[model samples]
Target: MSASPGAYRAPGAGLRALQLLGIVWTLPNTLVGCVLGVAGLAAGAHMHLRVRDLAIVFHRWPWGPGGALTLGNVILHTGDTLDSACMTYAHRAGHGEEAPIVLADHERAHVYQYMVLGPLFLPLYLLCGGVSVRNRFERAADRYACEGRSWWPW
Candidate 1:
């Protein structure tokens, strides 16, 4: 079957690993989630992913207002949501919710890294401390954005 546009597909190979890890790691904790889940995102993702109601996934990270990782998106804690934007409008700006501005620009840099660095970026990017990673990637994206590539809309 053909894929839809930006429907969020995880490549088959990646999906299998994610599923295996989820079953192994999450099955134990499922019961307690009957209580108010720490983050509704976890329950929601698990449900959608479990039944194949959604596409496969591999990585997801959340950014704080000042750019910090949300425990919900970290694999060791909440498992990966795989490219989730887990964004918020908490910090209203002149243009309103800055989450889109932050997330889109950030992820676009990731794409740019893939283009320029050609696969080495993720590994090297992960080596840095969390704060460094956030700053560096965002800056890389911003630099790319400033280049007037005319590819990214904004």
Candidate 2:
């Protein structure tokens, strides 16, 4: 018997396989994130798994300048809360809480990039101009957060 149209359904086998592949491909970066997460936890950060996003997030990470950083599927956030809302602490000109972009979505785009690029993501990200808006990856992630599509820089 089938459930209602809006009922939750498990992912198909092929989709699960692809998800597993992504997890494996991004393991190295995830490991680094895990290490940092552990350190954050030791320093009093709170951790939780966001099932819908399939990400581990550490809130109040005790580092960085009041924003979020994504490594693999892990998000290290430097605030008491993390959510799909425009980040007021991002310090971008003319963008505030009412901005269309969501911080969590932007970080999720980075997760997708790490899944596809694997270990190459960090070096390539640095070479592409690091955290600045000039970076293609940053631009793509911002676009993804604002438009809800097209996360890939290329």
Candidate 3:
């Protein structure tokens, strides 16, 4: 059972500050995501919002969530199953609600990319031929997400 609307918890002050930093860090991208999010919300899409460490995460299905992170830390979760941006499936698994838990690292990597590459990240991602680990952006994000993790089993 999901939490009722009355049960929704507001993020803490520190998390709100970090969320502000993220908005400043990503700027235009965050703005775009906000616009999209607002539109989705206006259209009656169900929203799940939270702060995962330093990032403000959201889940609103029915717009065909791409299971990838975009606009810094904003995750577009449309799939029935959760997968991190590195293309790894969720450790425990869930519907949209589990996205931040599963895809936080991967999405944060994209946030870093937005910081480093600014607006260029998008076009470069496009120019690199889009949506594959073969793409430099995707590869970099994967590396960032997987950093310091031991990969032996899966």
Candidate 4:
């Protein structure tokens, strides 16, 4: 059968192993995402939960987790979601059907970022620029997700 527009396949064992390591290393910031979940609840955002591959995902959040946390070194939004240290929280996107797959790949790349950058990802991500599609981190993540397919809209 043909795959849907945004269909995705899970990463292999080696990548999953690295993602596990990243999850452990980035726990401090992941806790921040938990807090935001509470905040989102208080603000009346309904969180839809799921486990996809390595990250726990929260979808359909009302208020955003924010672009970046100043002191926490936490990133709360990527594309239409927040790719935390261990979990990815997202809201519904008005974009096309391919959005989920695209965002998932990009966020998976962020998990790798946690592995590579450890405590420095935030500073460097901001130094390059924030979460714009043009930012180095975002661009790199996009590239990582696409696996050099070179067919992205951003």
Q: List the residue pairs that clash in candidate 4.
A: none
Models sorted by TM-score, best on top? 2, 3, 4, 1
Candidate 2 residue spans exceeding 4 A from truth: 1-11, 87-98
Q: What's the ranking of the predictions by lDDT, best on top? A: 2, 3, 4, 1
| Residue 37 local lDDT, model 3 | 64
Residues 1-154 of candidate 4 have per-residue lDDT tens digits of 7543235567799977876776777777666666775565565544444345244444444554533232122333323454322211222222222322345555655655655566776777777767664466666655554453332223
What Cα-based lDDT does every candidate model obtain? 0.35, 0.77, 0.51, 0.50
TM-score of each: 0.29, 0.83, 0.58, 0.57
Given candidate 3, what's the lDDT at residue 86? 27
In the range 1-154, model 2's lDDT, one tens digit per residue, is 6442123357789977987788799898988998999899988899998754557999989988778888988889988765646632233634444355667777777888988898999999999988885788987887776667788999
Query: On TM-score, who's better, 3 or 4?
Result: 3
Clash count list over all predictions: 1, 0, 1, 0
C-alpha displacement of 41 in model 2, angstroms?
0.9
Candidate 2 has its poorest 10 consecutive residues by lDDT at 87-96
User: Candidate 1, residues 42-108: lDDT per residue as tens digits?
Assistant: 5343323222221112222222233322111122113443233433322232333433333333343
Model 1 pairs whose backbones collide:
59-82
Candidate 4 Cα misplacement greater than 4 A, ranges = 1-17, 46-50, 64-101, 148-154
Higher TM-score: candidate 1 or 2? 2
Error of 4 at 2 (Å): 14
